[model samples]
Target: MSERINDIMNEEPKRGRSAFQPLIYAILVVLGVYIGSNFSGNSTFTHRPAASENPNKLVNIINKIDEMYVDSVEKKALIEKAINAMLEDLDPHSYYISSEELASVQEPLQGNFEGIGVEFMIQKDTLVVVSPIQGGPSETAGIRAGDRIVEVDGEHIAGIGLTNSKVMEVLKGEKGTKVDLKIQRRGTDDILDFNITRDRIPIYSVVASTMVEPGVGYIKLTRFAKNSYEEFMMGMAKLDEAGAESIIFDLRGNGGGYLHVAIPMVEEFLEDDKLIVYTEGVNSPRSEYRSQRRGRYADKDVVILINSGSASASEIMAGALQDHDRSITVGRRSFGKGLVQDEIPLPDESALRLTVARYYTPTGRSIQRPYGEEIDYDNDYNDRYDSGELYSEEKIELNDSLKFTTPKGRIVYGGGGITPDVFVPIDTIGASWYFSDLSYAGTIRRYGFDYSDSHRDELSSYSDVESFLKGFKVTNVMMEGLFKAGEEDGYERDERAIAESGEVMKIRLKAHMAKNLFGDEAYYRALLEDDNVYDAALEVARNYKDYAIVDGELTLLSATEVEEAMTTN
Candidate 1:
């Protein structure tokens, strides 16, 4: 009976052990799988890697070199170089700004920076005040154009090998800071002393605005800075008051600034809810900027001028207007830069302007040209000149795949710059090596400055731009003086070339003189009086029908055709 009981108990225990054996086997299999996935090179299991463990390869390499190097190395410089290299690999616009360069980088976008508020040039190793910024601390303190800053804060600065950067360092300071400047005026015998309270000085975006001709207004927008909209509005109002029926907006040589500033300015022309521009990228979602406010000049005829130097915010504004058929684009193709960069501040006060998204026109045209590792993207404008694209409309090669139709069925090309409706090929009719030498040698500028300085009293007597334009003329004596100056500067005088470019040189000299006397507004007014592009724009404003796009094609009336029409009319 005892043997039977022991046998039954042993069989029950063996049955329980058998049941647990399968569970133990299952646990071992899971442990093996986890171990293999975590350690094995050929593992297929998805185990999350730790954030800290997955260190940057570049950082790791840098650290290794820092710890085990032959000699001491500047870690900061190495890191900066690495950052720049990384950015360069990404895109052309993605760039790193060091701590030292951060302030100047933000100055234009900010519209204002605390400084003495005087435009200076290092002439003869002396800081010469080109002009005190309008309504600025220097201007308020009676600082005049052509005044030489001899001393700053009781320290003699003249003839001390002063550079522009050094001068800026000495003059620019925190707001409400006082700076005592000893000025050497051209006519004054005594060194004039003035105490200027350094304050927030504005950098104007609307460089110039005036009624170009009867019933036409011209506004030269150099950049889309912070106060651009305000400046633009004021300019437009001035034009409106002057009875301007049409507007010619110049964006030539404007290498763009803030996008927020541009969008608002674009909205000034576009109707409410109209798509201005859209941006998208792999990381960035499709975001659209539309006209939010009622446009100020919705019904006004506008002609936008652009060239290869026009980029970024300039392209955005131009593309929006073109896509919507709100304005007529005139000039050569624009600088293709449609990438949107976001300014990201690093911990070290350095900055990374990373290309976050690519922008498109309302017609879904990407204005950015194709870029590759081998391409010299910086010399693209030069390439255009070399390829004869700047001189002829036919040379502007457009891909059929890049074709996009505007709102009015007008076809526009993308994958490059914005093609103007009226393609004004670069006018190189009188451009000669001799004239170029004179211009590049600063002969004209020096002549203008000297002339202005000598006749400051007489030039300052002119109250308005119109008066200056009518009164000022580059005399034969002035031309002779300029040619002599050019000859002195190692530039051989080409009489034939000079004769060919004489009229242009005269106009430019007069413009420079005007710039010295009145301002940039007066300068542009004088310059554009004979500008072919400006004349073309005027013709467009007068008879827009002749240059209008019809059946997805533009009947761009040449200057001769427009002139003939004017004569007939």
Candidate 2:
């Protein structure tokens, strides 16, 4: 039986070993197929590139760095560097505003901010209050003129590298928030501390508006803000109600603001369907602005004033008036800032003020001057001066490439600012080094403030600005004091120069005093008596028929007839 069993086992090829061998082989084949299929599925799904992965072109470089680089590198830092490098190739006006500085940059253009409302200057490492804005928190807090802010919230802020922006950051807060300020007075020894509650401070666009002469109105605009058009209309309406037959719109130091504000302001002076200004750019769509309604002062004799600091929207208004032969432009040439900037917000709550388009006048003249890899702003006004364009009748060199004809067929030049129809040169007659020193040293302002404070009651007795001007005098004693003050500051007083500038000094001192005692209107009314620009404008308006000659032929009729024609035509 044993022999027979051994034979059967041998024939079966050993039950334990041979039976498991085939099973092991089948299991190995099934395991191999499962592993292969799993790997293939992973390659199609789990091995795919991530959503935030870099591009295919950078994959090889990344692999090389990962394999051979000496140090670990962060991808975020490299991405930021690339973005900054890209923005550097754009224009100077195109700028990035960080999230921290976004609100401060937008506040001024928006026309209101929460602050104490005092314009200040840092002189001699001391915080000097220049002027308290009218109807503001500072004024309401009884913050007087010439007060120095020595501390803010018990922290010393006078001379410790405090910047203007830093000071504003400390002072400005939400409306109704109280801020403690320690002030140092010139005449007082005790430090005065006041808890001032911040309010919505209005930055005015119309600086001063008054009836200059019997029938002429004067309005000075400082900036084109959101309320600029409304302010301008109010001034014109007031002037018209005050029996003003002619208007002088002063845009001397106005650095422009919103384009929308400027367009409507232009419409206030132009007739319906008149072209105001246009804009075009390489990547931007062409846009044309026209007056949609009749103007309030369409029939009134108008003169527009411009200077070197008059830029952007100011240039647009002056250029439009000049192109349409609507008003006489006086004073120096304007600042040529024709580019329009659009504020675009970023993902991080920051913003980008990007230059997107270039503005052009109604005559198709571009007001933008050339600027490239290197900007040469030094030749801006000096070139105009050297060419005798400020005071001479000699015509400016009109580049045929830039020439564009106005509606009246008058030739106008582009590639720069609007050249005034009547040029009024800067009055440098009384501008000696001594005068400059006195002006810069704050001697004139200090003396004026002191004088006004001392003689407030006496000065206030006068009925009006004209009466005050006639009665008040900047005496020889005052002049001697001013000269001595100027001399102590290392300025040698030239006797002949002082005598030549005596009238100018007297007028300036009186005007400053008037401003301190009464208001800006009183000051400007006094200063307008000797203004050469105003004199020229008055002359032009007085003889409109002769001055408005196109192609040397009289175009304007009598003033009354012109008004009638304006209404009829």
Candidate 3:
């Protein structure tokens, strides 16, 4: 044993290992001490420390807290907070989910949850049902879109400051459980009652899909979930049936989800053997996801719409498409988050979403913005806003040293998020103070709901969206009612601001009414007509070849010296 230790310490360093001599010695010293302490006459070497001698530091601190001169502390809550604080130091994306929060946190990504389904909003301290989820318990139990939930099991709940979670607590339950609701429905003299049985309600990822024009299909994807692929494929099939020759894939405000779902969905839009993304880490090997089969959707012109909120799996799709010149991306730069996490469960039913690997795009773009222990994670968006990057493409700072070129020779900027092929600045037109007040007071939503309820039969009369969009106008009477609602909510009307905002407000009002009658597809159909980003996306979709990236569009950190810097760095 002594001879073996001497041999290891005196071992000559390899040709390229001169720099590691000290580190190698330190490691050997520790190994020598460990082996010397455990080596017995037996062939195998092992050491089992006594339970008392091998105490965990965290448990020791916790035990000390219990015994110290402090009041009774909820150990579980403290531990959870400590775990969160520790993970916060690691990175913004790595997080801790307590047992109580675990299920709710996992619900959306899991694709469904057991509950009485109704999309709702709070207004005047009352819970107003925006829409009963199609085919869900509330919808099946005769709950309509305009109904206001006033009571639960005969107990008054309205006018008592209802919160989203409070409503969820009373409504969501295990399968087969029942909850009674008293609704103040529009056009009804008396309160309507419903006894709804809770069941597994699907949380759809593909929120909206429709033919935006004669040959263009628009699909709004909210997130990449377990069932997202199937939902997306169904949307694709809907577009195919509608004879769609081009697609506008909207991923604005999508925070992202499962990569597994995103990879498969993006693959259907790319040619065979195209690499979508690859993840690598110190422990994790390089894992590449590639398209296996060519689908009909690959031939169609596709435009990806992404805003700052689009991230993770959303970037995977946009990056892949832009890298391969399969599609053109519009909207602002995406929310850069290339870190891949793997949830590790602890004994207390809580879990830690630990960052395990970093994913790169097809052209070796990391897509992750710089992060550090001293950096304030919450100020990221504000910093971008303050820098004027959100409003101007020229304000964006591109690091040329981290740059790579795509297969089609388009300049690909790495390290940050996926920069759009064409930038669409944030729209501020018709954004008057009166509109802001109305939005804050929820006047538009309330008035739209009331109007839709009263005119339900007439609104439903239109069999197609084009007719409804063309015929349904925001009358003076409707505007008057909305103003009245705003005044009642303590937001007095400003004539000048109102004049400036009326057109935009009317468009939003039309969207809200469309949502109440015909769901998300109709809502987007009405809303996108007035959206600046959507307009840009539509043009890109119609003529992707013309709008495609060119060498002149690429920005660099130092244009004159990028070549020298790339080779040196």
Model 1 over residues 1-569: C-alpha lDDT tens digits?
Answer: 00000000000011113333433333332332333343355332234545654334433444566687677757566545545554566777777788988898778767899998887777667888778999898988899889989988889988888877788889999999898889898867998989989899998889888987788999999887778889999999999999988999999988887777788889988889999988898998998989997798987888999998888889999999999988888989998888887776655677667787899999999899878778887778789999999989999999999899887788999988899888887888778888888787777877787788778887777887788899777899989988888887788888899879999999989988888888888888888866777777788788765675667986767789878877989
Task: Give me the displacement of residue 352 in model 1, in angstroms.
Answer: 0.3
Q: What is the TM-score of each candidate against the true structure?
A: 0.86, 0.76, 0.84
Model 2 agreement with the true structure over 319-423: per-residue lDDT tens digits: 898888788888877777788777666555665566778888888888777766576554567877787766664545556788777766766778878777777
Q: How do these models rank on TM-score, best leading?
A: 1, 3, 2
Candidate 3: misplaced stretches above 4 Å?
A: 1-58, 123-126, 188-193, 547-569
For candidate 3, write residues 1-569 as lDDT tens digits.
Answer: 11000000111111233433443333331332233243344322234446654334423444566577257756455444444544555766776677887797778788899988888888778888889888799988888887889999877988887788888888889999988888887778898888899999999989888888889999999887778899999999999899998999999888788887888888888889989899998987998999999966888888899988888888888998888878778999988888888765554566657787899999889998888867665577898899999999999889989888887678878777889988999998899888988886678888888788788877787877788898889988888889888889888888888788889999999998988888877888898879999998887666554443347353323443555555677
Kindly give the number of clashing pairs for every candidate.
Answer: 0, 0, 0
Q: Roughly what TM-score does model 2 have, to 2 decimal places?
A: 0.76
Candidates 1 and 3 compared: the better one by lDDT is: 1
lDDT of 2: 0.71
Worst 10 residues of 2 by lDDT: 1-10
Which candidate number would show the highest TM-score if scored against the true structure? 1
- Higher-ranked by lDDT: 2 or 3: 3
